[model samples]
Target: MAREGRQWSDFEIAVSDYLTTLREKAGEPSYRRLAELTGIKFSRLRDIFTKQNGTPTLQEFIDLCLTFGKDPADVIYKIMKDLEAKGISLSNIPAQNDPADEANAALASADNGVDIDAWADRIKAEDSVHEEQP
Candidate 1:
């Protein structure tokens, strides 16, 4: 049973939730197996899951995401959405660039044989249209 009046940090809750989902999706692999696959210590992973004084480093988080074949950005977006649904303000978090800026940067660096500037322009136009919707 959880303690009453215990306030969980956003990072703690988000990471716990994300780990639970991953475990469920993976059919609940053994902690040892997960540690081997993700290059994280089993003891550390166990501590984090049990909220026993373990916080994952960014590299560890990224490694776990890759092990689960998930995009880190998608995970971050989901966590942000969950926080918003709970009426939790994320003002303490550093501001990120608008999604449009990220899209444009990705397009500019993509080596997929498409014209970077043209793709960026198309993305900007699409974003403008989306903003005008509803």
Candidate 2:
């Protein structure tokens, strides 16, 4: 279903590339080490790097940023800049008026034992449903 989009978005491509480059620059011997360092599964990291799946969730992205000693907002800015350079304007992306909304949502999901991946999938499903409507 994710492949229905004609390939990963520019943001995904940029983020995947950024992560791959960061891994190399950090001298991380393998994804296993990265997984150990970030507490994210090796398969998940592999999926993100290989683009075998869709983009990672904001939490996963933040984990990668912190693992690479980069600021999440700064990395997001870089990805946005890269996308703009490629003529991919995502200016229509909505902004959250309440920053705590994300934290509250994550906490609520965790209280139900829902991991980030599952939560992301749920959100994606909801988004797809909304997209199909008028």
Candidate 3:
């Protein structure tokens, strides 16, 4: 079943092409096997490769790439580049925040080398003295 006319985004086109190449390189294994390996539905795998489905969900896309021994991150980076080229404004979320100077200074000002073992021993001794009093 050929979809003669459908507009695919650059990301989709790139992903589809890469998947096609990988499929070919692996001697074109059965879609059933691909589904099992990727943990995706057999029908969905078939639909994606056959162009019956125009777009794959994020999980499907990632699983397919990883199942084929390809890094999903690599493909995702390409998609990011493609989106950038097309002037798509994606939110730039960072994995972690850089520590502020104030935070660093506060940490530096705090006493870090307090003897935890001595403090614990002293607390235990104080607790024993209280228990004896009662």
Candidate 4:
């Protein structure tokens, strides 16, 4: 439950979507039955199914994957690799208490006044000077 509401991270959405597919393949078992098999409460399973928990806990994810006869590592690796192709990762999620500050910090990092273009130009000028010397 680290994240919730409209701010669901890509990782969370991916996990939820993956589990949904797994559930479907496993005959779409009832939450009650899943609870009995997984030892996770039916209510919690419902929340996970509805995505009300934002993202399932690592344990819950692993348990569900196992229950569905899927390998959690394989599923997670595939999902992470796909997300990585899009330049996204689970680490991108901000803290729960005050995410605005974290977002603002990311924005702030873009304007740190380190002018790379200027440095490149300077390096080019130095290279030309060295060429003239040799």
- Top candidate when judged by lDDT against the true structure: 4
Q: Give the alpha carbon lDDT tens digit for every residue of 1-134 in model 1.
A: 74443455786578777877888898988889989998889987786666666466678778878888899888888888788888888887866679999897886687678776787999999999999999
Q: Counting only residues 3 or more apart in sequence or on different chains, how many pairs clash (N, Cα, C under 3 Å) in candidate 2?
A: 0
Report the lDDT tens digits of candidate 3 across residue range 1-134.
Answer: 76654566656766777788888999998989987798887888887886665577788888888888888988777667777777765456332335796686776677497766798999999999999995
lDDT per residue (tens digit) for residues 1-134 in model 2 = 33432367667788889988898898855778888988889888888888876577788889999989999999988878777778886767654357798888778777766487887899999999999999
Q: List the residue pairs that clash in candidate 4.
A: none
Worst 10 residues of 4 by lDDT: 89-98
> Candidate 1 versus the native: TM-score?
0.63
* Per-residue lDDT of 123 in model 2: 97
* Candidate 1 whole-model C-alpha lDDT, 0 to 1: 0.79
After superposition, candidate 3 runs with Cα above 4 Å error: 1-7, 79-134
Model 1 lDDT at residue 15: 76
Highest-scoring model, TM-score: 1
* Tens-digit lDDT track of model 4 for 15-113: 888888888988999999999999999998888887885458889999999998889989977888778788885576442356888776876687588
Q: If candidate 4 were superposed on the true structure by all CA atoms, what would the RMSD be?
A: 11.2
